[model samples]
Target: MIYDVYTALPTTSVKEVLGTFEKNKIGGVPVVDGKGILVGMVTDGDIVRFLSLQEKVYFTFSMAYVGETEPIEKVLKQRMNTPISEIMVKKNLKTLSTDDTMESALSLLSKHHFKKLPVVNGVGRVVGIISRGDVINRLAKMTSDSLTIS
Candidate 1:
């Protein structure tokens, strides 16, 4: 479990979040209230989407894919004072419990291609976070243990 979780509040500004990301080198954070209950999730992607107002898309031979977005720095500075609640992912968040299996967490992460999953307690407060990096490290360790030459 990654206990070094960073957090933000709904009232946190877009610039503040971006600065937090820069300082902490994290792509996202959990948005909590005064009590630290998980109210929503915020990511650099989310902020980018909000700043861009819409995403560009293109069609391929068989399918369509979203195109790249504009640089976020200018917009971040322009809308620096905007509250995070304006763009946070607040509805039907996919979360994990402390007792959840690593397999479950990995499956969800793989399916959604999420960078991190918030681990919550029974009362719905975030306790820790599990990231794809954590899963890969653990898998590497397990494989190494099984392949040890004795």
Candidate 2:
């Protein structure tokens, strides 16, 4: 329903968005305007791809992970302080209205293979997000109940 969204602003930083995504275990988040309209989306994959293409150094470490970062001050000087607008996907956004049927939502998800779709109003403001996981969870609960009843 309309209660499913975790909203964020477009002005947020790539680093900030990454933290939010990691903490929430979400693939991406909708970037909204003042009126709540969908402006763009930022995904974890986008950040990974952007970083992978950049020059990086590797060092052997006993830990399961290696630290990779450009110094914050140096990064700020290089404008790695750049905002989310630079990296977010701004075109060909797929969205649905609150009035749209569950079948329509499912179809959009199936066709686009999107983990989440922004739910918008007539004026294009984002009201919520419908995710594949949400749909699957709903269906799973329904199936479980039906089995128990039968």
lDDT value for model 2? 0.77
Residue 32, model 1: lDDT of 92
Per-residue lDDT for 1-150 in model 1, tens only? 789789999999988999999999999999999988999999999977777744579998999999876467766667779999998999989889999998999899999989998999999888999999999998998899889586
**Which pairs clash in model 2?**
36-125, 36-126, 37-125
lDDT by residue (tens digit), candidate 2, 29-143: 8888777778898877877665553334555665354456665556545544457888888899999998998889889999988888888889998888888987888788878
Cα RMSD of all models vs. native, in order, equals 6.3, 7.3
lDDT of 2 at 65: 44
lDDT (Cα atoms) of all candidates against the true structure = 0.89, 0.77
Any runs in candidate 2 off by more than 4 Å, and if so which? 2-4, 55-80, 145-150
Q: Candidate 1, overall lDDT?
A: 0.89
TM-score of each: 0.82, 0.73
The C-alpha stretches of model 1 lying farther than 4 A from their native spots are 53-74
Clashes of 1: 0
